[model samples]
Target: MTDFSEQDLSGSSFDRVDLSGSTFRGVDLSGAVIREVDLSNSRIRAAYFDGVRMHGVEIPDLEISGEVVRLVVNGIDVVPFVEAELNRRMPERALMSPTDVAGFWEAFGTMDRLWGETTDLARTLPPEKLHEQVDGEWSYIETLRHLGFAHACWIGGVVLAQKSPWHPLDLPWDEAPVHEGVPWVRRIKPDLHEVMDLRRQRRATVAEVLDGITDKGLGRRVTSATPFLTDATDLTVADCLRVVLNEEFQHRLYAERDLRALGAG
Candidate 1:
């Protein structure tokens, strides 16, 4: 066994080296060349792949999920096409990127109504099924918990400028880095009702903020007390709300998909 920490292995060359099951954390590989590598069954979390070019790659049964700024495939940038298709499938998604106070409120209202319906569907399932994870995704309960966290971070913490808005059961993303004074309890199994209570409180906070929002307020810059955004500048109120809207919209779809997979929908 070997270990390398805080050591610069720049320009290091290896041939026929077997480093299977090895761990690389906080390592720099910005310009490293990888060839003929077998990355089957490998997991990459919170990674950056800017300007990465892959040719002659076999990616059958591969799943990639994240923000897509631009993805070029065979000389075609498909991000716009994908966005257009998504907007066609989910008409309300086009509203998620609203540019006005009224649009923001409408977006939130649509999300609230949709979530209400989804939660109602969830209630018909067995109590234990709500805790079950389908395809290794977040369980029903955990999805709600993560939504609460999103609300707290973007709405309560950033928009309202609160120092601490996290609830005890609020769950951050699975790959989120640990930060002081933020809740990230993945093992806690609160009943659906308890989580719904938290959801109501979080939703109320958004409502209150939206009630007083102005068109000018949407463009007003705000900073967050959350560690992750402490150094973020020029974050507008509208930007924060849009993040919550996207999170809510995407996570609800994920929850609904998982619920059908569990045969509980």
Candidate 2:
């Protein structure tokens, strides 16, 4: 394996390069254009494909799992189909899209219980392993920090109309822009218990919001001036809360999978 770290290969063109079976860990391919490529039998995991435009592409047997939104297939958006199928597979998923106050609280309570179980599993592993990344994915501690950041973004910033609600330990998404007041420090290796304490505090904030939720509040729209969000000018209160729930549920699954891998290792 060749180490090409910190090398500038910009504007370099490869006509018939053989990169088959090559590994691309922590490589940035932003703003790169590919005319023709064969990705048959290729596997992609924990990748971000935001704002990517493709034409004349053939996709078959493609499996995607993550937060998929506004995905258009053949000029038709298939997000609803994907969401409905997912809800059918897991009936509890329907609770994530509740329309009433009681339903929202019930969904939150269910997620809280599920997360508790996952956290208990993490507690069995060595404290240092919680900071280790598995298969190029976020570490267990980073996942918790990201979840706290999600709560601060959705619940505190959007719903509660706070300009900046990020904690010092909160970690934002990788593609998020560098904001003035938001915490984007990825180098700080925080202790596992410290991250969990912050996570518990953020969960409590969500619980407070859920407790105060009403039918009218669910339908109401919230607008905020948070520096972290660029396009979240207008959003429904329920939608913002739902984003937090979705992040919590998805990251819990990711953390569980990584914890199992760590245990087996």
Candidate closest to the true structure, highest TM-score:
1
The 10-residue segment of model 2 with minimum total lDDT is 225-234
Writing each residue's lDDT as its tens digit, candidate 2 over 204-242 gives 887788777788988787767467665676778888888
Steric collisions counted per model: 0, 0
Worst 10 residues of 1 by lDDT: 224-233
Tell me each candidate's TM-score: 0.89, 0.77
C-alpha root-mean-square deviation, each candidate: 2.4, 4.5
lDDT digits (tens) for residues 1-265 of candidate 1: 9998878799999888998898777778898899999888887766789999999988876777878899998899999999999999999999999999899889999999999988888988999999999878899999999999999988888888888898999998776788887766779899999999999999899889878988888898885557666754578888898999999999999998888887865
On a 0 to 100 scale, what is the lDDT of residue 14 in model 2? Answer: 76
